[model samples]
Target: MTRFALTVEYDGRPFMGWQRQRHGPSVQQAIEEAAFAVTGEVATVHAAGRTDAGVHGLAMRAHLDVAKPFAAFRLMEALNARLRPAPVAILACNEVADDWHARFSCVGRSYEYRIINRRAPLTFERGLAWHVARPLDAEAMHVAAQRLVGLHDFTTFRSAHCQSASPVKTLDRLAVVRDGERVLVRTAARSFLHHQVRSMVGCLAQVGLGRWSADDVTAALEARDRQRLALNAPPDGLFFVAASY
Candidate 1:
């Protein structure tokens, strides 16, 4: 058997999430079925992280083991051919060591949240970005985001459904910046709790709107209570940008 590493990209709008689901379609299901069609083997695909419904992935890292004999390039071509019509695509593929793992070997992950700060209705960016009609002070948002950039108890930003054992995590970086009418929130960490990035972006949005002060964010973090969370941004704007080994 050979293990293959895959770099996948997908539009999250059409599927439930990265993982397979009984109720709806998923990115994993699509790719797995395509692989089965190509290799006639029941292979399990493991990803670096799982994204929620409506959350997209630009370059998700995944690995799967197959018993079929095929060159790395040929397998990638066959998988892509069979994955036709699905938004999921295998951007790159290569063989990896048997001990290499997509999830366990990952050391860092990053996500990007896009916000369209405009009153006009979205045309091309619909379902791809969050539209905030009210003007936002990106600079204020940036300053407030810095408060979440270190080790802290992040229970306030964690989802009630989060299965993580601990709410305490080290946030390596969190930055808010503006380019024209676009407000972007970029964050990185070893791993994140459920809804952690979206939750942080929501609170920072409040700061941009002048609804909350930086002290409010500090207080929320110190509270270590989920109820203290200001808001949870929708999944439309969230994108799994990359995973590092």
Candidate 2:
């Protein structure tokens, strides 16, 4: 069997998420089906990260094993041809050692959350970004984000349904920046609890809107209680930006 590493990109608007689901279509299902069609065998695609519904992926690394022999470029081209009409695409593919794993071998992951601070209805960016009617203080948001940039128990930011064994995680970076009307929140970590980035973005937004202060953010972190969480940003704005092996 030959193992192939695939760099995938997708628009999250149409599917249920990365994992194969019993109830709806998924990126995994699309790629797996495409792989089966190309290789004439049942194929399972494993990803570096599993995004939530409506969360996009810019470059999610995945891997699959195939029994049929084919050049890396040919395999990638065949998969893309079979994945037509679907939002998912294989940006790059290459042969790799059989022991390499998309998820287990990943060393870091990053995400970006976008917020359009405007009153007017979204025209082109509808469902692609978070629309906040109020003007946001991006600098304040950045300052507040610093509190979350280290190892800590992040219970307040984790989802109740999170399957991770621990609430503690080392947040490598978290920054908020504004470009005209756009507010961007970028974060990186080795791994994250479910909803951690969204939850952090929501609280940072509260800080941006003057609803919370930097001290409040620090207090919330110290509280480490989920109930203290102000909000969980919608998945619409979140994107799995990249994964580092």
Candidate 3:
């Protein structure tokens, strides 16, 4: 058997999430089926992270083991050919050591949240970004976001469904920036709890709207209570930007 690393990109709007689901479609199932079609073997695909429904991926790293004999380039080509019309693409592929796991070996992950700060209705970015009609102070959001950096109990930003052993995590970076009518929130960490990014973005948005002060963010983090969260941003604007090994 051979282990192969894959760089995948997909539109998350058509699936439930990255993992396979009994009631709905998923990115994993689509890729696994495409692999089966190419190799005639049941192979499980593992990803660096599993994003929620409506959360897109720009360069999701994944891996799968196959018993079939094929070159790395040919395997990538075959998978892409079989994955046609699924909105999922294999951007790159390479043979890797058997111990190099996609999830376990990952050292860091990054995500980006996009907000269209405009009153006009979205045309091209309808499902790709969040539209906030009210004007937002990106600088204020950036100031408030800094409070979330470093080690802290992030229960306030964690989802009730989160399975992480502890709510305490070190946020490596969180930055909010605006260009024209676009507000972007970029964050990186070793790993994140369920809805953690969305939750943080939601509270920062409140700060941008002048509803909450920077100290309020500090208070919320210190509270370590989920109810203290100002909001949970929708998945529409979240993107899994990259995963590092």
Pairs of residues clashing in candidate 3: none
TM, every model: 0.99, 0.99, 0.99
* Candidate 2 local lDDT, 1-245, one digit each (tens): 99999999999999899999999999999999998899999988999999988899999999999998889999999999999999888999999999999999999999999999999988887878999999899999999999999999999999999999999999999999999889999999999999999999999999999999999999998999999999999998999999998
Per-residue lDDT, model 3, residue 61, is 99
Q: In terms of TM-score, how similar is model 2 to the real structure?
A: 0.99
Model 3, runs deviating above 4 Å: none
Query: Which lDDT tens digits does candidate 3 get at residues 70-146?
Result: 89999999999999999999999999999999999999999999999999999988888999999999999999999
Clashing pairs in 2: none
| Clash count in backbone of candidate 3 | 0
Number of clashes found in candidate 1: 0
> Global CA lDDT of candidate 3, please?
0.96
Candidate 1 segments exceeding 4 Å error: none
lDDT of 2: 0.95
Top candidate, metric lDDT: 3
